[model samples]
Target: MRALRCPVVELRQYTLHPGQRDVLIDLFDQEFVETQEAVGMTVLGQFRDLDDPDRFVWLRGFDDMPRRADALESFYGGPVWHAHRDRANATMIDSDDVLLLRPASARGGFPAPPGARQAPGEPAASPPSLLLATIWYGHGPFDTPFVEFFERRVRPVLTEAGGEPLAYLRSEHAPNTFPALPVRMNEEVFVWFARFADEGRIDDHLNRLRHSAHWSEEVLPAVSQRWARTPQRLRLAPTERSVLR
Candidate 1:
């Protein structure tokens, strides 16, 4: 697997006004992708949340925390954002549902896609691949033991069951250096991402895990005990410019 060059990542979920998702996505794909990268961050992926038509989810990464701050300062302060901010903001109901995260393991960050991302105005791939993002919220911080548990026990089961692990990330507890763009500060979460060629593969993978004795008897019990709430699973379809697909 290719190693992620950007250690600092953001999982951004925006709730937009009804019927405005495509509008914002068009604007974002056209204006945001390369411009943000030019300012020193990677636009990892952009997706349309399958469960919520009005919601848009995306990821971006930076070299580290300090660079994250610098990049955000530059991009948000730059002329492009200034010119487009109003139109972009008009499509949103809320943009603050953000999560700050870092790789849970040394090689857990998302790898580069096998193919190049599409240029502006390029059409989305026909029947884009499906991406699964599972978020596990915890009452308290995910301690070292939990991270180890996931890496050693849970991950193997996932891979063995047909899930292609894309990334494993835990809550980044750093103070929000760019306070203008807020993140979920009071919550603790562990999130993992996987990719599938199609919906059938996802179902097959889940069925395998559900039937596995180890997964059902051992993993489920431990996860339920540690979990603060039920996990959030997002089924996402990549936009044309997404690199994570």
Candidate 2:
């Protein structure tokens, strides 16, 4: 298992000025990865929203809460960001209110990137696109039993429905460090991102899952009782340069 170097994570969803997603992805993939990691953060993975052309979703990590402040201060204050921040900001209509997170357990963090973060001008790897489903539970502090239930029950249901579970994560409860860039405060949520072959397959899978006796008899009851609200779902596809693909 790869060590989860970053105990603190940020799930950032950005609403871009129409058709500017690729423009920002180009800047991000070309210039942002190693530069931020050079200071202290890990650029985990970047993705394109298959359902929405104007949305970009990415993850970044830090060793701990304090480190998050130091890393952001350094990277955003550094020359690369200074030179490119305007362009990046220009692409986005909104970038704040990210989900602050950490690994649910020791083994719950992201897999290491295939190689070291790519430098500018390096050829990025081309991996097949996978349908990423992010299900966000409105309440969190999802404990051992809940995680076990998800893996043992919900995951198998999703698998049977043609969705492959990729990662499961819970909200990080650490105090906000860089208040300037705020995460949703006082929220308790766990998120799972899974992969499917296509949108039609996902629709089919959900239908099957709904009709499955086990899902109706046990899974739905457990989930409804645990989660505070209906789980919010996001359909994401990898960008050409995304590592998670």
Q: Say which candidate scores most in TM-score.
A: 1
Candidate 1 lDDT trough over 10 residues, lowest sum: 119-128
Full-model lDDT for every candidate: 0.90, 0.79
RMSD of each: 1.6, 2.4
Residues 44-155, model 2: lDDT tens digits: 7888887789999998889888889999999887899999999999999999849988777665667665665345566655545565656556655688887788878887
How much is 132 displaced in model 2, in angstroms? 2.1
What's the lDDT for candidate 1?
Answer: 0.90
My TM-score estimates for the predictions, one after another, are 0.95, 0.88
Give candidate 1's TM-score: 0.95
| Regions more than 4 Å wrong, model 1 | 1-4, 123-127
Question: How do the residues 66-159 of candidate 1 rate in per-residue lDDT, one tens digit apiece?
Answer: 8889999999999999999999999999999999999887778887667777788787554479899999999888878888898889989899
